[model samples]
Target: MSDPHIISAAVQEQRAAIVSQRDFENLYKQYAPFLLRVCQALCHDENLAADMMQEVFCSIWDRRTTISVKGSWENYLYRCAKYQYYNHQRSLSRFRTVQDSVFAASDESDDSTQEHIEYRELTHNVNQLVEQLPDQCRKVYQMSRGEGLNTAEISKELSLSEKTVKNHLTKALGFLRRNIEALFAFIFLIS
Candidate 1:
């Protein structure tokens, strides 16, 4: 004879395996915000983060019938968010490489050469200005802009409050802005 407990366990397993629309809604409600925060922390752009988070949830819904969760949903969703953010970044890098090649091939005239030289000079000047910033300010600026880290990550990594990180970044940018204005004016007069 069939064991009653075994049959009941099998029934519960079958029910738990299929996520209903209501179950999906509940998961979205509970984790969407958290997922969005994860995306933002990775990329620091609100709209892009939102889009990536939405894509993760949409993909989940599309594959809901075949998906099996063996662990906690939070970890699963967090991995999904990270995967989406990295995927988007990879795509952007590829697109930029292609775009740069196209632009490079299309512009080879004297004006293009002059523009390239100007761009190089401007970049060099910016680097010099960045290097001139105070030590902590430079580190904060580089982490926030060069490494694309958000203020919170910079705060944690540097063991400073978020407000202090912001202050450093602000001072660094302000100093750069003031100096770059002078550089631009000098360039404008020359051009």
Candidate 2:
């Protein structure tokens, strides 16, 4: 691999100009492998590392208009990759927490075996309902209820207004409540 500083300098010089697709491709060719290695080290999965790299590049492209290269583009790219990696880990952690809570709640019931099965089913149904939500609403709900983040935190993290975050949460809860009611009615009818 050539010196990263050389590539970084080239990118920095062109940072103020409009990034053409050719420039973006050149940047990707130079940085993707390095960023992939960073992601793979954090995730320990090749496919996930590649996905993360793609996401990072996509993010860069999306925010290209306002992007400012301060010190080193290499460092900035690594920071973006690291942030994405931690975000993925946080999502996984939240999922595991949900599973653990479901088991714990079920275990406390008198009919543990039956309760466990019911709890699993309820969790599955809730997950499906969440997946059906619009992208922003689903993300807000996950960051709030799933990761236990406050509305202000979610707003900052997602670059949304606090009111927007509240609206998404409200929308998600309303959708979930309606679906859950229907699901319960169907279950009762079947049982």
Candidate 3:
């Protein structure tokens, strides 16, 4: 091989005309083997390495018409290859990171499903407790809490006075609080 600095200097001085077809062919012959080896080291596939090497040569050929070099051609080729490899690895890492994040989100969805099941069980228990209330109290409680109605709205719906609605709510709340306290104590003892 000729001196890399002299080759680069010649290419730079002559520009398009100096980088003739023969010169391009020689450069490909001289550098393709080493460039492919570099690509293989980075990509770990012979076919991919060959493809990347071909791309590198094509890029260099396209830029040969205008590209100027101030240093050794060998160094420039290696640097370009190294940058391409780094960019490839960086993109691969980003894809892996996104995949990992999606996997983690899937796990969270599983946790959310378990939480929803537990919530449904709790709602069922509370619904059973509500059913045990006096019919009028249950109706008033449902009307007040479920529909987000005011005492006046509940009063109107049940044909009861506001004071009667308040009395039903108070009794229902007292019964629920006492029952819940006793249930908690029983659970603690059982556990």
Candidate 4:
């Protein structure tokens, strides 16, 4: 009584509607190698391509509930592969940036250690010269240079006249210059 073509068509529609678990499994198995090949062609790296293929399949599985396969399944899988490839490329770029920063910081630390050693040596030599100054002159010099005080502030703190403070700083500078010149001359002679 019923047309066979119509009945067959109805059964086919029912089968599409159900979308059996076995069909999805077979789809994954069939397309996996193809997807991996597509990924490899895009990335040119086997391990990265494999990772992208897995990510693409995981994304598809997550959205499988609402999937309406309009065109060939091959086209859809290829599009997914393309997106995954781009995403992986972006991840690679970010990883490179992090690696570069880590290397740059290590290099900076090496340079900083050299600079710190030079600074310590210079400060130690200056401290030794400062220690050789007269007691009151040394205190005034420390307040002016170490504590960053002006002559007026140093005079107020030490209960000395501003003229006296100025004289102390001038004497301290003359002492440091003479000491540094003599030390450099001695080093040159030794060398």
Candidate 5:
């Protein structure tokens, strides 16, 4: 069996090295997969879980100078991941609440009737512009804006590279901006 003193010395050396980028990279390489699994189990969405895992690592790296892991590093990392997941959930909940309130207020406003009509017209025109986009660009723009999918998710669903998806979205936006300058200018004046 290995000597307990030797094992203790190795752990002490590792703990002392945690402030260095190389040590942090080693820690990330060793623990990122396990942390991602934990995040996936908690968040229940692959994209959100990946984001949470990244956030956990970012927090760890930011706090490296002051972090004090008393016991198992695995436990400490898991706790950080859990906290990040909870924070993400809370932020999403708050955003939804604010969105709901805004919609509710808008619905209750009779003065907004004309504004709503104008908004719908603008939306129809925008849809027409989107439909006029090249086939691949139209598909990417629709999936991103109408379906609310992120670039990575859109890339996976459509079997395209993420960079390609981004390029398509950029092209679509540029097309819209050029075609809808008048409508956007009106919007800019109002809001």
Candidate 6:
């Protein structure tokens, strides 16, 4: 394979080169293998890698007469594949947050005994973390989270100012967040 820097420099010296059909085919033949490997490594999925590689070549072919590379031809193609992969990922735009996953799994995977046990264990661990909070913070958290009460409702029920309830909830949540991350990792591993 020719060095991309040398090809890039030569093309630059000759001014912008036109990518005719023959040039496009040669470029595809030359770079497809390497580009596919790069995409495969980045995506970690063979089908996705192939799709990305095909998109890169197809796009180049579509814009054969107009597309211009400012730097190395290899680098330009690589960036095209990378951009296509990212665009595909962004297009998914699905919600996969941990809270959604954990809670959703409990409702959806009831057939699995193992999952139920894991959920029970996770619940127990979370309760333990909640118990470790200060008395007022723990009470505020229980009212807000366990009782599904809003800030105003909790304030009225506890006979405390809204701001004070908010502060307690914040402190309790922060403490739980710092502690829950490790437990979540363990659940993720076993599940």
Model 4 residue 88 CA deviation in Å = 0.6
Best by lDDT: 2
In candidate 3, what residue range of length 10 has the lowest lDDT sum? Answer: 182-191
TM per candidate comes to 0.49, 0.50, 0.43, 0.46, 0.54, 0.43
Model 2 segments more than 4 A misplaced? 1-13, 109-191
In the range 1-191, model 2's lDDT, one tens digit per residue, is: 89999998787776754367887878888998899899999889986786678778877887767777777668988999999888767756655665576567566777867887887989998999999999999999999999999999999999999978976876687668557766755654564
Residues 127-180, candidate 1, lDDT per residue (tens digit)?
999999999999999999999999999999999999789668756765675576
Across residues 4-52, which tens digit of lDDT does each residue of candidate 4 receive?
Answer: 9998777655434314577667888899899989989998988667666
What TM-score does candidate 1 reach?
Answer: 0.49
The lDDT of each candidate is: 0.78, 0.80, 0.72, 0.75, 0.78, 0.76
Candidate 5 root-mean-square deviation in Å:
10.0
- lDDT per residue, candidate 3, 59-127, as tens digits? 787787676655666777787788767765664565566556646756767787765775687678778
Q: By TM-score, how accurate is candidate 4?
A: 0.46
Question: How many residue pairs clash (N, CA or C atoms closer than 3 angstroms) in each of the candidate models, in the order given?
Answer: 0, 0, 0, 0, 0, 0
Residues 1-191, model 5: lDDT tens digits? 99999998887666753688988888888998999899899888876676667667767788888776766878887898889878667755655665575467568886677767867997899988888999999999999999999999999999999978976876677567556765554544554
Off by over 4 Å in 1: 1-18, 109-191
Q: Residue 175: error of model 6 in Å?
A: 49
Clashes of 1: 0
